[model samples]
Target: MTSKEKIISFPHMGNYYIAIEFLIKHTLNMKILTPPPITKKTLELGSKYSPDFVCVPFKYNLGNYIEALEKGANFLVQAGGGCRFGYYGEIQEQILRDLGYDFEFISILNAEDMNPFSVYGIFKKLNQKLSFTKFTYYFALTLKIAEIIDKIEEYIRENIGFEVKEGSFEQLQKDFLNRLKTVKGFRDIDKIYKKYNILFRNIEINKPKNPIKVGVVGELYVVMEPFSNYFIEKELAKKGIQITRFITVTYLFKNHPKEKELIKFSGKYLKYAIGADGTDSVARTKQLAEAGYDGVIHVKPFGCTPEVNAMPMLQNISNDYKMPVLYFSFDSQTSETGIKTRLEAFYDMLLMKREKQKWKKVI
Candidate 1:
């Protein structure tokens, strides 16, 4: 069977699918099928086949694979990372094979470790005629695309709450993402980003002098994928809270601080890199607290060991600074209603705290 006829797909994790698709299409010689968007059906399907206690992301990925496979995706890819995440590809591959699906998978583990020769070998296996130079170009372009998107998103998170016209930020963001799908090279990515940057700035806003500011720090997947966390950031924004999140592909691939740096940034609250994104969560929360942000929300999938490990340290920091920290754990069985209710209460409490501070100043 000729491999050129195969279709490639990877699990969706937010608007980053455009970057993933751009890389695969430009570098590899196979057709790409963007997985169906995550939905209730996707979660249910993923949960059904997944191990009873596995983290929810694992189930979501499996569900994405099944949906893609059903749509004729014979080639699959999974990202690699630290903690339980690094081993996900092998286990998912095993489970899929046992379920009788025939497909190819590559777990491109860890961005730091994917050197030129390793990348060349991986791509060469799929397309023997692959040009290392060409692949390298597109790969760099892919990283650039991801970096640009991360900056745009950080801006959106900060300003999305204060837009004078509802959905202006969101609608502009949607258009920008659609434009990303058609990018051909570095020039295209730069043009799209520049265009959107101006447009995003021009959107009118009525931000208060002291808006309720919140920083989000958590497990990588939950922080990056809005759906995974019940769109917690969106809910916060809907309450007119200015949101800031430092985690993104740019942080992971381009600007991730070293272990020692993470410890230093986190202050005495953390002395060790707590594995995966755990240390960064602690550090970013500390930074947010010191920066006078109103609160922090830390999210993770149920049973995620790294984020769980960081919780005590987070609480310590929260206590030290009197900063409020909200925690949410997601699972296949997590309730939408419970999440919304807790979020509403959290927003109200933050508002109350800010009002109380003002009254004390008045006296």
Candidate 2:
């Protein structure tokens, strides 16, 4: 089938649309269709059809598949790990079939046969008409774009709280995305990034006297997609809290090996991998605690198993390290106001803890 006849869909993860844009630009006749950003309705739909105890990412992605099918998407692409997620494609496909949706589904990562070549083969199938040379060229460019996007997002998360002007970082981010769309080559990408790097660096920032730092972890989908989580980071930044989220596409795709090393470093504490993202969540929570972060926010979809398994361990880490951690489960009926209130309370508790630490040091 030609690229135009295929529609690629993945769960709402960080900057996936950016990655999709890179794919479309490189492949001829390809049209991309992303599921609408996850919301209360998404969770409701997902929960309605999914097994009650299924992982949250499963429900979310299932909901996405259903929604995309309803919206004329004919091809679904599932990319993830060697755990239950590796098998999600089969289950989700069957569910879609039962729902009477006619579509083609591709699972990119096959646990038993996973290799670089296997991965490249999937990409080749997705764009069968593209020459190998062209595929290599576009893949390289996409990696570069992913790196730049990750760096920019990390910078924003770390510094957005200090912006002297409200929405300055967001506005600049919008401008950066617009500029990125105009980039046609490596040189153009570098030029745009360098210009914006300097522009953002020069912006005056007022460091909060006692900044509340929150480390976010959980099911990859909700944590990575701002829209999926109702812009939770933005709301925290607006409250003048510095936010640190450990999940990024660059880390997941490019630095998975290094992360694997870190997981090994966790050793016996994280003995069994509950699922795809469970191991990473445990390691990240520990790292954040060791880094002296004030608090951690764990966001998961309603039925996510890996994160559910990680939560008890996370609580143990929080207690041992004397750090605060908040857990939030998102679904269609979850109230935004409730989330905001919890965040406000978490922020207040962190600030008070910092004050106590200061007084203790003074004494």
Candidate 3:
């Protein structure tokens, strides 16, 4: 591959983006292209080209690979899973080749067949020509920033809806991220943490008179990647809707055991794990609805079986709880306009429901 050949990957999750940024910073003469956010169009294009029986995520990623190659990306990176996704790279590679795009593909996996190692190796390779001490120092700093980003994003997801200033959390988050890129050491991380902690903690947030709380649940990728869902959380926050999303890197890596408890929380409603994130999502949505959330948003990649199977059950839960639910299936070509319109309608319905509840309480 030429030194100028670009490596590309789709935004499957937020942490992947952070890891990619770290990798990109270390590689020499290599451009890393992050695919555009998945939308309806992305899904349509993916579905049009992909095998009908393949899962939704496969189609979405396939679309991303094809689109990225068309846009001059000559190298592709696939990372995720010891399950179905572990083998997705080969299938995607073949599909892309059949489509006539020439590219080098890298699969990031560890010896144990778990964890993303190519990501680490890429950074290591980039640091090879430099001082070992300096490389370790910078790599440590980058890892700290990645951890902080995860923590801060979790906080924001849980509380952004209640923020007094509609976009305060997101704006501070952006500032914090920008600051993170400039930090160089442990001292810098501490300073950055303290500064943002105080800034976010001091913001005056009001409890809405009738808060429209919405819980978002679905496949891991679509839930975390803002590009995939078109910034759905931000849109909900702007509408003063309190949002709760159960999936996060922290939950996936550190809290797997707690998932059993969560499954129990879902009661007897959903039995058997569908696949990947399907089981967790169904459980979380049930709990959220029972907890008096005004609405739920279930997002998945187009044609995802586990999520697709959960939809009817979600609708049943919606009907039983009298809560509104919106489903979004994303791919590389998904339409932004349609997503926004559906969200607007969902918000209006939730707001009206809140009003009715308030009136009932007053009576």
Best candidate, lDDT: 1
Candidate order by decreasing lDDT: 1, 2, 3
lDDT of 3 at 28: 36
Q: Which regions of candidate 1 fall more than 4 Å away from where they truly are?
A: 1-4
Better of 1 and 3 by TM-score: 1
| Model 2 pairs in collision | 40-332, 55-303, 55-304, 56-303, 56-304
Which candidate number would show the highest TM-score if scored against the true structure?
A: 1
Would you give me the overall lDDT of model 2?
A: 0.76
Q: Model 1, 1-363: lDDT tens per residue?
A: 235488999998888998888878877889999998999888998898888988998888999999999898998898666778777788889998889888888877455456667877888888888899988888888888898889899889989999999999988988998888888877888899899999999999999998999999998888898888999999999999899988898888678888899999988898778888899999999999999999999999998889999999999999999999999999999999999999989988898999999999999
Give Cα distance to truth, residue 152, candidate 3, Å: 2.1
Cα-lDDT of candidate 1: 0.88
Ranking by TM-score: 1, 2, 3
Off by over 4 Å in 3: 2-12, 23-75, 82-85, 98-103, 109-112, 116-144, 158-170, 183-187, 203-210, 331-335
- Tens digits of per-residue lDDT, candidate 2, 1-363, equal 333476656566656567667766676455677788676677678778986766666777788777877887887876555456667778788988898887788776454544446656777776678777776677777778878888888888888888898778888988987787776789988998899898888777898665778888877667887756778998888877888987776776667655456567556567666676777778888888888889898888776777888899888888889998899988655688998899888888988898999999999
**Alpha-carbon TM-score of each model against the true structure:** 0.97, 0.86, 0.76
* Candidate 3 C-alpha RMSD relative to the actual structure: 4.5
